[model samples]
Target: MELRHIRYFLAVAREGNFTRAAARIGIGQPPLSQQIRDLENEIGTALFHRVPHGAELTEAGMAFLEVVAQFPDLAERAIRAAQRAGRGEVGSIRVGFTASAAFSPSVPRVFRDFRRSYPGVEMTLEEANSAQLVAGLRDERLDAVFLRQDTIAGDGIRLHVISSEPMVLVLPSGHPAAQREKVALSELRDEALILTPRAVGPTHYDKVVTACRDAGFEPQMGQIAPQLGSVINFVAAELGFSLVPKPMTQLQAKGVAYREIEGEVPIAQLSLAYRSNDISIALRNFVSRTLVAHRQPRIDE
Candidate 1:
């Protein structure tokens, strides 16, 4: 009936004597005997044969023992499962990243650290533009996201800035500016500028535009690339020059060279985004782990 009944039954069956079982279970002998009798009545089966010196298993007792003997082990496993879930040690997390954020070493490092620390968690990764990644978070399709943005709008969305890097110029390998160790932004006033559209990443797009205007020129807009990687590809094809985060240099596409700006530089920021009210254990653990890996402060702190 009750769990106490199961314990009493197992103890008496193990000791093979009511007095000894009572001592083992730290209960009075009379109460133990009464509980055992109650159990037998409920099951309509005597579990032990009374003997002069000690109790022995009845035919029915043997059958019951086989079934209830597994309870202790099963109960232990169930408790462990519940504990792991409560600690956020098991479950799956869906993480989305913008194309540029994926190029940063910090993104992969966070994932690797999380996997090493919580091996039981399953991780799913998706790459998309900042707009789509934010949508995924709002739609509850993604638990968290890594993206490049200075600001995010709308309710129920939270952002944590991970790191910021200066933007660099992506130029054709044979271009004159590519040969220089540092290029001035004012010098490129007449060159066509390839850029990611504002709709894809407003913060990054605006930063580039403001930087150009501050340098005393309105940039000549040329071909537009939908993604950061495509910006490098366009530069490789000599379609136009573009500005990208310094980490983009790692792309190492042939026929493309990276040059630093000589004066005040535009910055690209990488941030983690999620629902403001998300209560998922996996998502909480992931956000904490990422902030720890990057040495960024947690939103709560």
Candidate 2:
């Protein structure tokens, strides 16, 4: 039997008459009676006793009514849950990001805002390299990701650029260059440098190398770190200095001093990446609201 049958049966049981029940349900008496009959037949039991003046519940009807009494509340809860799900307020979002992105306040601010707005939607954050984040997005293992814009490329992935800022050099606090407010790229030629994994994002790594090369000499690469946090930590420990996006400097690393890189090398761009074909209304709304809320500031400004 269909849902209407259960509803008609419940209505008739409550009203104790087919005519009034049908009226309440906006259906005619005959159709309501037929639905009740269908419901009884489907259940292989008679649910009512016919009387001259009105309908009365049978033993089976009494048990059925007790169970069906809960239906109205159950149906209401189910409908509300479905609506919340459709609104993207009651599901889980798997978000991936690089170590540097985690250190940035904007990323955490977005997450806090999202949680406050959709408390029912659980967030699972994964920290990885840009390459791994991109792969997770591509493999459908991640719902979305925050990473450098240069790391995201491919037809199916959509990128919404959130911010771009000038690159800064992180040096040991005791380093001589730390005294300068802005360090020229040429000055780093002979300095030991900490670099991110070249395989993580060849374009970004190349940009760093190329920027140094353009300054008239090749960089003396010292330590290679898999993640930006490690690179910054290494710099704090005086292992080597590294070039990082400005936002990363916000991270409190003892003994690490930040200086602006004085040159025309491209600034780091942060973006939200997700599947272009994603049809989740909640995800779309989250992305749109986040972009509107976190518009990038001009690097010079």
Candidate 3:
């Protein structure tokens, strides 16, 4: 019969008396008795034995009561699932990030906060070069990506600058430039530079190259690393010099010296891009939380 009938039956079965059961259900005893009869008639069996003192369950009623007892918890769980899905708290979001973005305080902090706030949301992280991160976003394999790219080339993409910081140099600790707290970009003109390929992070690459050009020298490129973190390893190995986001200095790239560039501060950026038309609630929640958590004034509103 109806859920109310099952509930009414269960209450009567528990209380063992129609008057008390009706009192618990806030219904008149006569109506409750009639409804119980109606349920029995519908189910084709009696569910209670009418006794002088109170009602005892029939064999069928005992079986039915056992099943009805489980409904409350089941119904509660179903309702909770609906509420969680409505609130975008139950689902999976695949996120991509550049190695450099992983080191940025904002990125990791946002992830930690998101996990803590929405424990029901399944978070999968893909760490790759910026180019690969963008590709994952384009292929729809990822819901969002954090990267540094000179140009985002797809109409289907919506990109936002999540974090920004100045680029700092990573040199061998024994290098002559390590003697200075700050070194001019021009002073490193003759140094062999270790940099991630332009394809790996064109925006960051372009910024570094443009800063060098502004200082009046074409960079003497040396080793090419596939990932940003690897650039530091190259520096540690004394392969060449590298310029990375200031946040990257947090990494323990032993034997490497971190320094600020003199005169002007060149900017390094971490951006997030997702499908422009994606209407998933989970993705929207993540983006909004990130912007708010990092105190980055919401740009897209």
Candidate 4:
């Protein structure tokens, strides 16, 4: 009736003697014989034919033995399944990232390497602004996020720096500065600046502002874009020059040109954020693996 009954029945069938079966199972012979009789009564059929020194199987006994023989293997597989799940080996994780962050090495590189180790985990990536990504993590709608930010808000979210790269200038292709391989931060002092608003990513926006200040002049503020990719589009439209992560250069815009800065380059932190209270085994496994893989190193300007 129970798994133990099935196991005991199989053992007795295999050993052919009550004493031998009980010894194999670490039980007493008398209890084993009584248990077998109890099992037969429950099934409403005799399972064994008692002989001179041992037991033989009845027609019903042979059929039942075959069925019970599979129970051990099945039980083992069930246990193994639970163990694997407990270890967070198989499940789904919903991840969030900024449009530009996807093109960066942090997301694609870390995930590409993570999948190799945890192929059973299904990863779903969504593109959102820093604000939206933060909201998703707070609401528990997203399992994790990769974004560039100066300071992250909310006590419910945890942030980690995955990669660091110096900020560069994205200028209109027709701009005179575009012809220069390197431009000075102070050179942009007189030019209008385009940037993602503080609401979208206060920390990242501040990083640029702080760098410009340290260079001896506050950048002249111009248009405000809601996201980094739009910051690039604004530059391509000749709206204004903008500071961006070096990795942002990978985003192809023929109308735009990327130039390194001559002064102290502000380092952009490519960061990962997730709900502090997230208890998903899949999400936890992903965070654990990624942290082990990505140790931030400051990139040169």
Using lDDT, give the best candidate's number: 1
Write the residue-wise lDDT of candidate 3 on 89-205 in tens digits: 989999998888888878888899999988999999999888788788888899998887545985898887866788998899999989999998888898888888887788888
Model 1 / residue 88 / CA error / Å: 0.5
Predictions in order: lDDT = 0.90, 0.82, 0.87, 0.84
Question: RMSD in angstroms, all models?
Answer: 1.4, 4.2, 2.5, 4.3
lDDT at position 137, candidate 2: 85
Q: Write the per-residue lDDT of candidate 1 for residues 1-301, one digit (tens) a residue.
A: 9878988899989999999999999999999999999999999989999899778999899999999998977888999998999888899999999878887998998999899988999999999999999889888999899998867997899898889899999999999988998999988899999998999888888999999999999999999998989999999999989899888888999999999999999999999999989887878889988898789776558
lDDT by residue (tens digit), candidate 2, 1-301:
5556668888888889888888999988888788788888889999999787768999999998887877777888999999999888887888898877776688899888998999998889898888888899888999889887655555999887787767888899999989999889888778888988788866567777877888888889999887778888999888888888888887878898999877765577777889988887667767866786786432223
Output the TM-score of candidate 4: 0.85
By summed lDDT, the worst window of 10 consecutive residues in model 4 runs over: 292-301
**Candidate 4 residue lDDT tens string, 80-179:** 9888889888888888988768877667877887788778888888998888888888887888998887457657777878778788888899988789
TM-score of each: 0.96, 0.84, 0.88, 0.85
The candidates, ranked best first by TM-score, are 1, 3, 4, 2
Candidate 2 TM-score, C-alpha based: 0.84
Give the better candidate number (2 or 4) by lDDT.
4
